[model samples]
Target: MKNITDYSGKCVLVLGLAKSGYETARLLKKLGAVVTVNDGMDLTGNQDAEELITEGITIVDKEHPLSLLETNELIVKNPGIPYSVPILQEAEKKAIPIITEVELAYQINEGTTIAVTGTNGKTTVTSLIGDMFSHSSKKGLLSGNIGFVASKVAQEAEPEDTMITELSSFQLMGVQSYRPHIAVITNIYSAHLDYHGTQDEYVKAKMNIFKNQQSKDYLVFNDAQRELLELYTVNSKVIYFSTVRPTNGAYIKDDAIYFQEELICRLNQIVLPGKHNLENILASIAVCKLSGINNEAIIATLTSFEGIKHRTQYVTTIDGVKYYNDSKATNTLATKFALDAFNVPVHWLCGGLDRGNGFEDLDDHVKCVERMYIFGQTIPKLIDFAKKHDINYEMCHDVKDAVSKTAKFTKHGQVVLLSPACASWDQYPTYEVRGEDFIQQVKSME
Candidate 1:
């Protein structure tokens, strides 16, 4: 591995002491970079922050110190910190380069990186791609959004290893000169409006993943996302994947997954459900084929690839009523897809912190659902919408109560689905925690 310039004695400001922030500070300190960690919240109860402080890293919490920005030569920013933040604005004015954890990892690795970014299906595609490469002779590292920051993985990755990263729009926003050899945008939908302010801005943020790619690199996108595809101005070799089989790139035809180069997998044999997943499978096929994996390996791996849990995961049948934990559906479009995937009468558990989303798009599913169990901060708005549409609905204080009530209301041949069409921050730390709580509550009924 090439030893890049040592950060020895360079002042680095690490903002937002979350997992990525703390990891950056630790790595910077190890590389001899003078690091000051700053978070806007106190570390009285945060174990992660306490651990970093114990390691002798300078800690600033409760508020971001303007002085920290003034003295720093480089700012390692968490994706959560918007560019509009006063401290970041000041840093920009002073001409200090603001870098994200992914960029830092990219600079250090300087190897082949395959980044996956989209409003939905990114995690599934990223994992599937990583699995394909890992199953083959090539070593691969799976990180970013799915789990672990890229910087942490790059520390251990070999030069020949491929990094299959699931990047969020927020992470892509802060990236500069971080080009991936293979970049895939599965699909774009209305999401994170609160952070990006508008759909256009959010789409632009996702597009940044391919902004630096050259003609030699590969850019995979869903032909279905017409608006998103039209925005790309890069000269990279483009590949399109679609659920409705296309003439070129990767596509599905007659229940079979195909690449432009060869047939990959029989789509009917795939264990993962939903039309959305077929598109994800297509993206994975494109990535695998481009990386030189044979058709036999792609089909074998996908046939055995059980879908990720908490994502349209089947919970159990209690008193003949099936329950699915789709707590990962944190956006209206995702929940819409989930609802469409099932034809049975649905006791839809929906509501959470509203990300400026509306319920109008869900009217078709709302009609199909037997009843709606609304919870979290957005319950009132959902309830109001239901009332206006004459949809049957009830409110619960939390997810457990919602699940309990849903089990009671459901009957034989019916499904109780926890597909909150909004963010889970109102009631849980993450969608995973919310999904786990739902699973536990449902299992307790049996």
Candidate 2:
């Protein structure tokens, strides 16, 4: 990594003025970089843009003026901005070094950094790792794809602190020098094909999480992931987490959660449920052990942890029906895992932007689904799946209607789960927003 202190007087162009880009711009500006931020939105006295403008950071909005590239030493691309964009192409022509904010955050961070990435459980493992650090009395700031930008946390990071981050394939694809002190891959699965162009490319993108790690750096991984086992190689010192076998890192055997040779806790003591969650817990335990957290603290955190807001979050129980908000399940594999977590009959609130991949992937799990409330652009595709699987289903306008409709069919002790096997881009901007909408709609039932 280049000297972060040398950013002063360097010309840095930040593309996309969303929270990620905007914060990167601020950090660059703080480092004395002559920074310019661009977004598709027109410049206005909108508080955030205006605040940056007043900070003497240039805010160019509404369009990407290619001419501005003449003097740039670096371009920081937001994870959301596609490389196919003309301005980015122009930057490539100019041979400008482009990287995500996390890369820059790593360049500037003095704290020990831990990054978690995978197709399904990044958020859960990331949150649990951060919680473990909190119980160990270490300062752990959680960030990245969970809504906190890494660089935003880096600005306040001290050497004594630790940074726990959740990374997505998009963020990892653009990373250049963003190696973590401790890196983790929960597991890899086919996801984000739309952005990655292909499964191989997506797998390669995720493997970037460990690209720069050295032998001294630690890699905690899911030993049970066949996809990971078949593809990708890790150079860092590896510690494995699994449910099937004894591992050097963490594992579960006969209901006991073990770290290395020691028993951390029993599986029944865990507050979070499901086999996938057991995988998440094992991964989190491995990370916590690497961070030197004691077993008692780890067990305490595990017993109290209810999981993050969206992924299988229990919203409420009304009229003997339990509603779980898993709006974060943005792909079929995630939805499948969510289903595997529950043995009870589920009235699933599913569907979203159709990726054309169809429902063949989730066919086996359809038997557990008592009723499917389909919604969004993928209604027809899911409805077809419902028919093929011979499961009862109904079409709904959105999450609100899905919740209301499911309520009528849900009897006591049944589950109304919002585990969309598709992304939320069709109806809402983010999964967080969609999950909030689902929570509000569920609350409306009373």
Candidate 3:
């Protein structure tokens, strides 16, 4: 802890009490802030809430009454809670300082931070960077969007520790002055438009990762996004990474990944699947090299590491048919990448919450998909795409159903892939839950 007394005697309201909310409330209370938690769900018999209540933290359940804002000087909200919420909109009117847990983490953190944000690949890159540091002399504390709440990890981290945080657009929008020492925007694309309401606003939210950075800090950007570079101005020292060609930062030269001029590893040595992962690898390499990690440690981590769970993760092969769980796709671009990774015929399982977007972008990418196993709220949307493309299709209730259907239809040398190109909220609580369901369903077949 920074021994910072800045928050002492302040009235702080923590909106939406999930894992992040629980952590944030406790942290604020320790800082001498009078904390009040507002959760839409009933917290009765909730052990986490009970612990907080015993500790003198208040809990207001069922509704977010705008009256709570009258007492709260600051609002630390769960990232998923929209600003369109009545209380949040009123807070904006009252000029209350609203921030996500990430901002609070940034304020009290003793560790140097390396934050990553993108449409895709951020989780993989963040995790890989953490692994790289673990293999090297330095320590990387993984936090934020990857699962471990940023505030919780920051409390334990020391000055020597490096925080490798994976931030989402939702989290970034709440930050006021959360500047990391090294920030990376792997690659931005159209995503979470339902939350942001526009592509430009979504891009703006992603841009917040580097907005507060100073001249001494580094911004590791995708060199391929010339349009993004042209449109957005980065004030920090820019280090570019590319899967295309040579760059000042990390780049592919002669089939090997390099940071500046030094070689890190060859393309063939990497075990992680998908060509899209090459961009992630390059971004990770840039961050590691910037942090003074050696090529040996970088190469070691890259070669030994398999893909992240539920992100194109290879499941067991049953009767010569391989299964992969990529429930974290949640968008068309990610699904396209997952589809492109396989050369063999794929029993493509997809569909989820209907964001009212067309799947025309994936029209050309479904060439290798032998059949489409559609499920969830977006089934009709996916079915329309399949019909238009003259592709084989089947409709299912959810991921488990899709997996079961896929197993029956898949043959020798073919693949069963659960890469839902939509949010998991329609059927499951999280993408992890949906992926676990798919995995368990596949296991039952054996």
Per-model CA lDDT versus the true structure: 0.84, 0.87, 0.92
Per-residue lDDT over 1-446 for candidate 1, one digit per residue giving the tens place of the 0 to 100 score = 33566678899999888889978888887777888899898777888777777787888889976888767899989997888888988899999989888888887774578999988889899888877776788788898889878888888778888888889999998888899999999888889988899898998999999999999999998887656577569778889887765647898777776787466667677877787788888889888888887776677667788778888999899888999999989998889899998888888898999777787888776656888899988988899878877778888988899887875577899999999999898889899999999999988989
Query: What TM-score do all the candidates reach, one by one?
Result: 0.95, 0.96, 0.99
For candidate 3, what is the total of clashing residue pairs? 0
Best by TM-score: 3
lDDT of 1 at 224: 74
How does candidate 2 score on lDDT?
A: 0.87
Which regions of candidate 2 are displaced past 4 Å? 1-3, 226-233
lDDT of 1 at 381: 86
> Which candidate, 1 or 2, would have the higher lDDT against the true structure?
2
lDDT per residue (tens digit) for residues 105-134 in model 3: 999999899999999999999999999999
lDDT of 3 at 103: 96
Better of 1 and 3 by lDDT: 3
Instruction: Report lDDT (Cα) of residue 219, candidate 2.
Output: 87
> Number of the top candidate by lDDT?
3
